[model samples]
Target: MAKINKRRKRIFNMLKSHPQGLNGEAISQQLGVSSRTIRSDIKALQDALGQYNIRIFSSPTKGYRFSQFEHLSSIEHELFKDNMSNLETSKQRINYILYKLLANTLNDISITQNDLAEEMYISLSTLKIHLNEVKNILKKYDLRVTQYKTKGIKISGEETKLRYCIVDIKNIHLENEFFQDLIMNIDTDLLDDIIKKVLSERKLQLTDRSQKKLCMYIAIAMQRSRNNKTVVYPSSLTNKIENTFEYNVAKEIIENIYNQLNVDLSCSEVYYITQCLLASKKLIDVSESINKKRVKNLVNIILKEIHEKLSIDFTNDEYLIDGLTLHLNIALTRIQFQMNIRNELLETIKNDYPLAFQMGVIAGKIVEQYDNIKINENEIGYIALHFGAALSRNGIKENIQAKNIIIVCSSGLGISVLLKAKVEEYFHNRLNVVKVLPGYEVNEKTLENIDYILSTVPLKNIASDKIIKINRMLQKEDVENIENKIFHKKDTDLMEITTFFN
Candidate 1:
């Protein structure tokens, strides 16, 4: 099981309060995290709940709720189980060691075996065991760990590969004590204020998650610079970056950091930091500088591959072409700078849109061919979102059943029958009106296969969510409202991408 965090607990508590439940946006409001994070947390919580005879029920309309409230106490305990003990787990320790090694390498700090063991609260023998696991992880990234009796241990690899490995470490280990320690050492609030001020002054807006990531990249860069591990940007790239507004803004941000932290960074370090800033923020138009022939060929090949392999044609999608070209150009910039591109919606995109993700993988292969840089799953997910949006625009529909609705009316058979027919005429295959019954006749057993109840009369004992009151003769506005509910609804299982492959 994944480590349960405070956000997940708060989310569960909030959902527990509203048995009728809350949507992603509503839950996001109650908790200050983004909807994306809430969606991710919901999936993790769902997986964790299965063992407790509890389940997180979700739908486009209902958001999420626990299936069995009787198991709440047990579920809560399980979420908090092994809280302090989690750090001692072999997998957690391995992640911690990997994070320490990568972060120290970037900061050019060597860690002695004894110090490492002490930091991990493990004996030398146990530390060695975890070190072996760390080595295997490093090997996957084509990196090697070097240890010496005098100098301790450090990781070494190609510069770009090293950055990529650090990105991987950050993704896996950000919640651990090691990363928390790194954050605690810096005045992150001051850094955040300055970053916001600078971005506002420059009129460059980033989403909450993007802004958070930008601050993290800056913090990492600052930590490395403090340890005398300076970044050296290639001269060609440096010259190009120096001419951009992003580079200037990076300089300003660095200057603010120096003022706040009393640290000086080398010009190359500034240039490198500038690239990191640009990586997480919106891309400035590089249409004039991008290779038109290369991007055009890449798009044509991607569309062709999707057409031949999946029988999906998007040849006439000029808007797709324009949008994709811009995205590819930005992607190339990130590759050139060896910057990590994170897509928080990656899991959702992959889960909800399998064919789009497959097409994205094919496109990613073409991207890999054009540039030697291997695209990560996160980047591929972003590409998939583009294709998914394109598919939605072109009216390519998925035959997903929205719900199994039970209709209830207090009126006689004629009125109930008319209501059912109206609903069926409107919703069609999107929903199944499984049963029609008088309101007084309805009970818990009748709701067995039902997603929810559509009632002409108000339900007394039934949960608010179990019955949705509607007119016997539905108005045009009611039809539109139901249409919105059926069409724009997101699947409750936010982790549909992983589910698809599994």
Candidate 2:
């Protein structure tokens, strides 16, 4: 399994670099794996990348290119439904549970060894072994498990390290086929009600459209909870409500039950719960009646928990916070649209981290939009491809060196020294600095072959071509502006024109 994972990572990297994808035969040779194994690996990569709006395609001439990255922003708006179909196996469910458990424990500071054991219903020895294994897995990324008696057990590491651990664990768990089968069998309705209640108690509103969406999201979450991949949506509600208002209210109640009690209901399980919410929504406009303070508290709790537990800090940027609050209110407007609640938050995310967030949102949206679509990690590979492409297009340009120029300043010290430091900081990699020429020792040879001149003191009767004026004192902004001008210059020749005072 480790070997397979390594091969997958290598193949992913190779594909990312070679956007016009590599052939299976080439991949096999590169990884030293059999063609059969490469074929399977390709399929897995495709499924993983699907969520990111990346698709791998084979062609006679071009070989392969992740064709989706260019339009991932648009493509990710719709869910990839194809990937949803294969998630029904039993092994998939186990993997899902394992990942969720690990993610939850790693994120939560309140969770301890005993708490994990009890929650998992495993013996202490088994729990310890499992945690040890998890720790071993985390060690690869320089992340460590620190068991604190006061703070509880927590995974301590940098943000990037934590992300790697989470993504790896989730990927491995989702690859289980048995859990996928089990997920396919779980009832969606019961799961939906449970999710709705959780949202409502958290003060997140769902419109009619969102209510259904939330139900689906919950179904997915529940399926994930059970270590399964597929969720079964029910055809009809068991207890039908007379009025729409009443039904919406009842939906809230069912959602509440699921949130408070971990007893998730299948569509069959929460048929009545759906009816009640629908009826309540029709009869009473509970939107106005909801306590504002309570809602605020709920949102805070959810966001705080997600941040602390997941180590996924959705930084409280002003725009992001405002956007989340706006979306939360919009979701509360109608219980039916509750599931669509996160859409606005996602939109806000796009605004903040235009590249990465947009990519993630688009990938998620594509999966939500399409049913039965299988996307894999190759989609992320494609995003990386596009990112690289963008960088290549817009990043720094190299200049052809006319002559190697060396800079000299007074005494290698003092305010003239500070000027030297600024010049070095700005042009260290781009230009070569030889030695500092003090005022008394300065000679014509020092200026002899120098292509350009930078000086704090005025030089008399020196080579006219070698003289350029520089400020005696350099400011912070001066350094920044100079670097920016050099790095972003459209004309390459201007790169060598180092006029310090200007």
Candidate 3:
């Protein structure tokens, strides 16, 4: 039986003997446990009983009562009986408290190691041991829980990386229950109001996106600050605005207003401009920067290079150009941030664009420089953008229609899905996948008109003129091979080379 069930049974027994019911203090005294422990036990019992028609209620003067005990099923009784032994051990309780302390300290800026030990009611040596364990857990996700003599232990990593790391940790340790309880106790609606007031005081109107990003940044910054390391500043606010708005018109509006008001366009200055742009009733041309002629020319050059070098056709479209440009800027920003270099965007583009994988390769290089950091191929949006930017600058014009490919696999659904994910990761917006057909379901008729064929199993009937065999598990070399095969066909169209940017 679980420990909680045993405690609940004991409480029910006590109430039955008392007739009027036992108050919290009486139960705690009788059970030889702290009031807090008893309360927690009561909550656990309530949760357990709630699954059935059984109900436990509390009266301010009379204390907790089993109001509908008769309605409980034999199965419920058995289940509750089984849960008696699951009550947390004293050591587990200590660990829980220690985890909470670490989480809170990670969200504070000025707390020191000594301060943390005091707050957690533990000796410095004991605190250090607990912190070391937390740090080891954090290291698996390429994050570190660092401590300084002047500051307490705190988590540090890239924002998105750290967010995912936290998600992992929460899943592993089942810490969501504790967080849920903590959040439940707070007035979140009131907190939102308070945040709005705070932003208003700073003369900033926090848009939904800014509010969310700022919150995340502040949380992570505080975590890093607790380790006595200077937190990295967010990317230049202008870049964020441009990426979010994706138009110069919004920027122009702000620039004109600032000129009239004589307000210097500082990082903080853009916040209000973003708010105004979002509030505007007028719908300006968001795609005005996307030049169709320029995009067509760039697409043609890329297609030509693919035909001569690797033999693949990417139907160049306006969407691809916009997507690629956005990705490129983000990649450049990430590289600059990693290198701790400010205002070196042009240098990053000039030096890295010639590489085969473009921004993806560059991002991998940056990740290699950081200790224990790993960049998965799935996170290579910036690489796609770099390719787009390169094409734009070279001004090679081509018109190619986008094509769809269906993969066939006999290695089962799981492996087929993995390969599909890898293909999507590498190709980004370049490839359109119609579906993954199992080898048994594949027919020559179905495969005849497919743009490309990727298969884990040997083709029984070759119908498609273009077919590429890939392993069930995709590797880096495999991605390169696939790229080479797709771009090396002779009949693919080539375009006259021109500068990407005019």
Candidate 4:
């Protein structure tokens, strides 16, 4: 028997459990050590394991996992028992439960609820609540939870829906608070980097959130493919997606991931990834989409339907038009592929914003009528979130005293268009953006009637308090600055916003 260093023992345990591997970033976070120190430790551990057949393989993408293993369990007592992070939040626990149940189903294995609860370090009573939440989420994908006498609970569904369910669940990512456990047993960072680079090269667009989601799907698809489980689309549907741009993008992404992870996904995986892209909230120029007659007509119909049904007028609201045009195009793809996500915020939206939800239902029905397909509660809830924003915008117009504002951007055209739109859309007549001027163009007359000069760079000779510096892309704090400094929105009326639609 050889004496092992304390740090090397812990690293060995993490490598043993994480079959897929962890990047230096993830491993360092888990171990509370510097990446430089981790690199040294991995080297020392590799030398120690040389006598055994175990070898550590590193990839630029996947970090490190064992490349070879034999009789490694013989040294198990020399290492710490477990390196998995404890499930703390309800978010983390439910995500963990979903992964275990789904992974077990794919592997054709079963364990009792007692066994699972023990494995997760949770009480059986507590597990029931988490399991119930998981069951409700599964229902959205036509997946049902099944219990067995000896084997614990398992998800029962079509192969395709099961994979979609996994994809829809964004693995519990708690940043610095979590380690080795939150990723549903796989590192998504590698996949995310692969997908991000692919999309950038191809010039396709996805929001940051959507890109993370696509990575989640790819990670799950790769794991399941390893388990010999795969998504099967109808040949006609598959053929249709195969010819699309998203399919080409998926092919490239998967090829890159294959090179990194050494996992060759079934061809159907490519088509499924294409469907994920279509169902994703695609970011595109509103001006470009509004010209499409179908999207324009659909937006018009949705706006008219909401107005007629709710007596709220938004027919000419360009923000709403832009929002719906972008959303409905993706909704149409989601509907086509039957890709539905259980919106975690759906219940909150319905309870807190009834009128907004009603508007969403109305909008959903219009989409259904336009395409002759039913929109699920999940989709309706998403539509409602946007409607809720519009309602809030409409409500605040009356209460908040409108302020004149100027935006100063150097070269002001491209970036200012987006910033100006975001400010106008969010403030919605509360802060009137009087003009966008370059720093060189900021004269006294340009500053007249302007309450705040929202600028990317500080203008010389301008009063510091009067000029609010903002990112080229409007960020959370930038919005907060405008809200607190310009509008004094915290002191603004709350009554109209809560009671207006009622």
> What is the TM-score of each predicted model, taking all chains together?
0.55, 0.21, 0.33, 0.58
Tens-place lDDT per residue, model 1, 303-376, is 88888888999878885776677667767777666676645556765676787789889889878876677998
Q: Tens digit of lDDT per residue, candidate 3, span 246-339?
A: 2343344335434543323443324333333332211111322233454345444554555455443344545444444333233333333231
Rank the candidate models, highest TM-score first: 4, 1, 3, 2
Provide the overall lDDT of each model, using Cα atoms, as 2-decimal numbers: 0.69, 0.44, 0.48, 0.70
- Put down candidate 2 lDDT per residue, 1-502, tens digits, no spaces: 1112335556766776787667778878877769887777677767767666578888767665677556644643243322223323433323433454445542253566665543343457866766676667667767777866775677666543443344344334455543244335545666555655454454434334335433443333444445432223344322222233334544554456466546454443243333223222110123432344544544444345445544544444332233233323323322322211112223332343355434333433343333233433322222222222222223223334533444344311222323444455455456444544433234587677665556555565565555555554444564554444434543554656645436
Clashes, model 4 = 1
lDDT, candidate 4, 1-502, per-residue tens: 2224455667787887888888888888988889997898788777766766678899998889987554568856544244234456887788777767766776777768887765565679999999999899889779988876666667788987876665555344334232223245555777777887787788675644466677777777777777788876788888767766688888998899789867788898898888788766554422221135787788888888777777889997787676666666666666777676556557876897788789888888787776789888878877776676565555444325668788876421223445666677677768777766556446666666667788877677766577889976577899987887776775565654766766
TM-score of model 4 (CA atoms): 0.58
Highest lDDT model number: 4
Could you tell which candidate, 1 or 4, scores higher by lDDT?
A: 4
- Candidate 1, residue 288: the lDDT equals 34
Residue 194's lDDT within candidate 1 is 85
Instruction: State the lDDT at 425 in candidate 2.
Output: 47
- How far does residue 258 in candidate 3 sit from its true spot (Å)? 21
lDDT (C-alpha) at residue 12 in model 1: 76
